[model samples]
Target: MSNNTNKILTALAAGIAIGGILGILFAPDKGENTRKKIADNSKKLSDSILDTVKEGKNKISGLKHNLRDRAESLKESVEEFAS
Candidate 1:
């Protein structure tokens, strides 16, 4: 993924975390309920971010392998031509 895409994802994750916390804090629920809600939301948010990062890491790894393959092919062609 592009840097812009990574930045956007990071921002989105941060926004979700901040928004969820603020909403829970301002809610009129009991302390135990509020804590539970916070824990659930935090777990959800962390899972989402972890998934996205893993996806991005896989994409980048694939791209790296592809580029290496292409570069090796080009090098072989150049060596054949120079011989």
Candidate 2:
């Protein structure tokens, strides 16, 4: 993974955690309710991160294929021109 991607992911996680904690703190609720909310938010954050990772993997794979194709095409052209 790139440095920028790492930074973005880290920032996103921090933001979500801070926002969730603040929201919970301000809301008038029982301890059990607060815990449940925290659990639910954690699960959602986990799922979101997984989805983002999968998407980045897919995009990288696509770029790899695209670059490979271009390289192969250039090689073929060079061979044809030399012959």
Which numbered prediction scores highest in lDDT against the true structure? 1
Cα lDDT tens digits, model 1, 10-30, are 899999899999999999999
Candidate 1 lDDT at 11 equals 91
Q: Provide the RMSD of all predictions against the true structure, rounded to 1 decimal.
A: 2.5, 1.3
Tens digits of per-residue lDDT for model 2 on 1-83? Answer: 68898899889888988898889878999989998898888888888988998898899999999999999999999999999
Superposition error at 64 for model 2 (Å): 1.2
Inter-residue clash pairs, candidate 2? none
Candidate number with greatest TM-score: 2
Q: Local distance difference test, per candidate? A: 0.94, 0.90
RMSD in Å for model 1: 2.5
Cα-based TM-score, every candidate: 0.77, 0.88
